[model samples]
Target: MALLNQTQVTPASFILNGIPGLEDMHIWISIPFCSMYVVAVAGNCGLLYLICFEDSLHRSMYYFLAMLSLTDLVMCTSTIPKTLCIFWFQLKEISFKECLVQLFFIHTFTAMESGVLMLMALDRYVAICYPLRYATILTNPVIVKAGLATFLRAVFLIIPLVFLTKRLPYCRGNIIHHTYCDQLSVAKLSCGNIKANIIYGLIAAFLIGGFDILCIAISYTMILRAVINLSSADARQKAFSTCTAHISAIVFSYSPAFFCFFFNRFGSHVIPPSCHIIVANLYLLLPPTMNPIVYGVKTKQIRDCVLRILSGIKNTKSHSV
Candidate 1:
């Protein structure tokens, strides 16, 4: 459908440009991407299994960690397979409906991850600042409700993006200059006025990312104050140590995300398109790939449980042989 007549016609499919200048290197590139995807899937799955089946791992902190792992799993899964197909098989075309579906999952899970991080911060805050009430404050029922609320908030904020993108008439060419379909990326393909799309995208990002960051900051601030006042050096060290993994997770998850978000909108003139695409992919891939390793190394309980599980398996195998 041509835009020559000023009559709007939606393209049935959009062509994803896989790493604009690095097309020749895509096969080589997929090596690391595929590796990361495999690690992310396996590590997150292990975390979920441990948290679900190990009775000792069922605290509020681990519950929030499970949610973060689940979110990372889905977020990476939703994009990487198709991305690999695009890179290795030259499968660049995604149906319009499929694009919208991908956009929904990508954005929704991104928001949900932020929410989960905020919840984790809150968990640490209560655990450190109000240790006496930690159990009562973050009971299983409360955790479930918090999880539900986080999910609902993400859904409520992201559904409009689907509609907004769907309503845009794709009179422009159907080629998206990236691996996967994102709201702003897809919106850029439309010849229609996209002020609303841009505005709403910024607002949603601000509300989800900004609000969550603020809450996490406040939680940590209070946690720091409480830790400082603790008389015992050991107690203070323990409290800060418990939060290290969560803090690392937050930094790994948000830093790339915010960089890509602002860079795409403002840094295009200064940054290469390839760099943007690479960062965008990393924004989804890095956190999932790193979170498990970070937590497994930082948290003694998780590390000990994993060691026990591995030893039990080893013993079973030796006996069977």
Candidate 2:
């Protein structure tokens, strides 16, 4: 039987999942993924432009949206291009070091994105529950501090993960089932006893994923309570409507991750690999695409600003003609 030493397993096992196929994969998957990548980038770029150019959008809500767009962009940038190269361009087998870099950035940005979403939920709760306090609570300094702290926390927490993976030996088969270096998949590749890694990964997931989701739920609960006390039905409806898109995005993002972690633990490995990749892509891509559209519809100022920006561009074109 083959044996693994301390240096046998490359860090790349944690970054690139495996070079399973250079040819046999369906073209259909690659094409749609490319389309989604384009849409995600374009949508996020448009949101950034709208926020930067439109002075009226300088408010706390829109500022938070801008940060959300940035996080979504990071999320897409981290996963999509590499995935495309693997699936479409036939560029498989990333270097061990490159894989670790990818793993770090992917987890960091994703955790940060989750943290930002939780903060946004809190922002909404503050806005709806204590309208007067919204400015005080969601000030630039406060938002900046929260963002910085969240980022630092994600970076610091995941630092240990890199070191842990680096120490694992890879004597057994180096094949990872998924496209990317997911925790469980990577752990399965380790030749050493991986009970510790498994426990750590599950704990990290519970702490980061479970904790963030819990915070979001609590924020929404408080918001709901405040909404209930509102005398006007219109007020309650309007408040809830503003949160609908965010709620949808959160549910979409969290549910699949939950399913992947929980269901796969039991005997239900029925979910195919392709489905997992698609859902992961959706979580990163869909939010940026939907946010501007939803917020534009929900907020009158944003709607008018987008329309005016469109009109101005058209007028400029007409004048040039």
Candidate 3:
């Protein structure tokens, strides 16, 4: 339908901006952005690889970590490459179809991250709140089902926007203010009525991502209560300690995201353009880069596995040399 609409009317392409006022500094700015992208990709990939290859790490928590790594990697890939092109190569033009593709993957993966975080919260809740029944409650098949549900939820909610966006008439010039295609950024460019599109986007975002955040908060609250009820101080400490990794991961993931949300919605006049833009980019890059380190430090099992893997590679290199 969007393609049909595009046949008659639509911009041929859209130009993406890196950081509006910092055009001259794009090359320099891209250096740190590029470094973060590389670290995020490498760190997430290594974590995923560790989870897959290590038998001991094959459990519910690792399962959610795997999902998160995949989602974050996709989100990073969707934006950073094109962003690099704009900054370094000065190639800002992106075709309409390609822009939509980028838009779908970016938003879909972002929502997927929220879904996976919810799953992780549930896993922690079950493990802490029902220790004896944890195995029975979240068996391997059940974990697989949870992951599938996460994937379907993310995809189904965002897929409609693809068609809706495709059908909108684009009379506005093709220059997008940001580095990538997004719902609000794209919808604002339409020549026709955009109330429906904006309304639907808000509904989907809140229904899915908002619901996930609410559930996560509830899950943690229960987990905290359970921890406090334990008789021994050591037991309480241990249980709370176990949650630090998830808590850190959640903070790294959501802090920048919510800041970006507010910065976009309410900071138009208050926050400077460069500050908001930097926060927006960090919202996409910070989680994957920090998640692994948080988990490694907070969860001994992951840290041990990572160390073993690194040591094995080092030994191999020494023998070869």
Candidate 4:
């Protein structure tokens, strides 16, 4: 339909602004993003290999961890390559279809991450609040089903946005600032009335994104109550400690996202362009980078697995020596 619309009316070419202090920024952005891309990929890939290869890690928590890693990797891949192109190579021109595809994957993976976090919360809730049923309640099949549901639902939910984007006429601006197909940024460029798209986007934000956070909060509420009632100091510490990583992940994932909403909706237009660039990259990059750190810090098993994997490689090379 967007293609049909394009045929009907000639869309104007959008003029793009090179980053201020372009020559200096060219090298500066390159160094950090290059390093971040390496870490994001390496950390996520290492987690993926550990989860896939290790037999002991084949449980509900690791299942969710693997999913989180995969989602974060996708999230990083979608934006970082194009971002590098823009910053280092000055490759800023992206076709309309390419832009929409980027938007879909970015949102799809993010929504799936939200769903996975919700599932993780449920897993914790069941384990802590209903200990007797933990094993049966979170069976292998059940975990797979939860992950599948999260992935499919996220992908399908974004279908409407694709159609909505197809309907809108984009004659105004082709150049998307801040390095990626930010939904709001794209919507702002639409030539036709985008009140419907904006409202729908907000509804999804609050209902799907915001609602997941609420569910997580409620689950933790029950988990905390259960933990407090436990008689053993060791038991309470154990339960609370188990949740620390998940709690940190939840806060980091949701805060910047919702804060972006606040800034976009209420903040002044006078807000610096750097604010947009910084916040956008932070939200995209932080989740994947911090995900490994959270699990590594909070979960001893993952940390051990990471060390074992590294040591095994070292031993292989030592033998070669």
lDDT leader: 1
Could you give me the TM-score of model 4 versus the true structure?
Answer: 0.91
Give each model a TM-score: 0.97, 0.89, 0.94, 0.91
Name the lDDT value of residue 259 in candidate 3: 81
lDDT of 4 by residue, 225-311 (tens): 999999999989998898889888888788778767777788737566666566677788888888887788789998888888789
lDDT of 2 by residue, 1-321 (tens): 123343365443433442233336535677776786787788778878888888888877777788888887887787778777777665666666666676677777778878888888988888898898888878888888888887887888777786677677775665555566655566667778877777777777777777888999899999999999988999889888878867866775676566566645763467566566556556666665566566667678777887898899999999999
Give lDDT: candidate 4, residue 162: 71
> Which wins on lDDT, candidate 1 or candidate 2?
1
Candidate 3 ranges with C-alpha deviation above 4 Å:
1-8, 314-321
Candidate 1 lDDT (Cα, 0 to 1): 0.93
Residue 177 in candidate 3 has what lDDT? 84
The sequence of per-residue lDDT tens digits that candidate 3 reaches over residues 172-194 is: 77778888887778878888898
Cα RMSD, each candidate: 1.7, 3.0, 2.7, 2.9
Pairs of residues at least 3 apart in sequence or in different chains that clash in candidate 4: none
Error of 2 at 78 (Å): 1.2
Clash statistics: count for each candidate = 0, 0, 0, 0
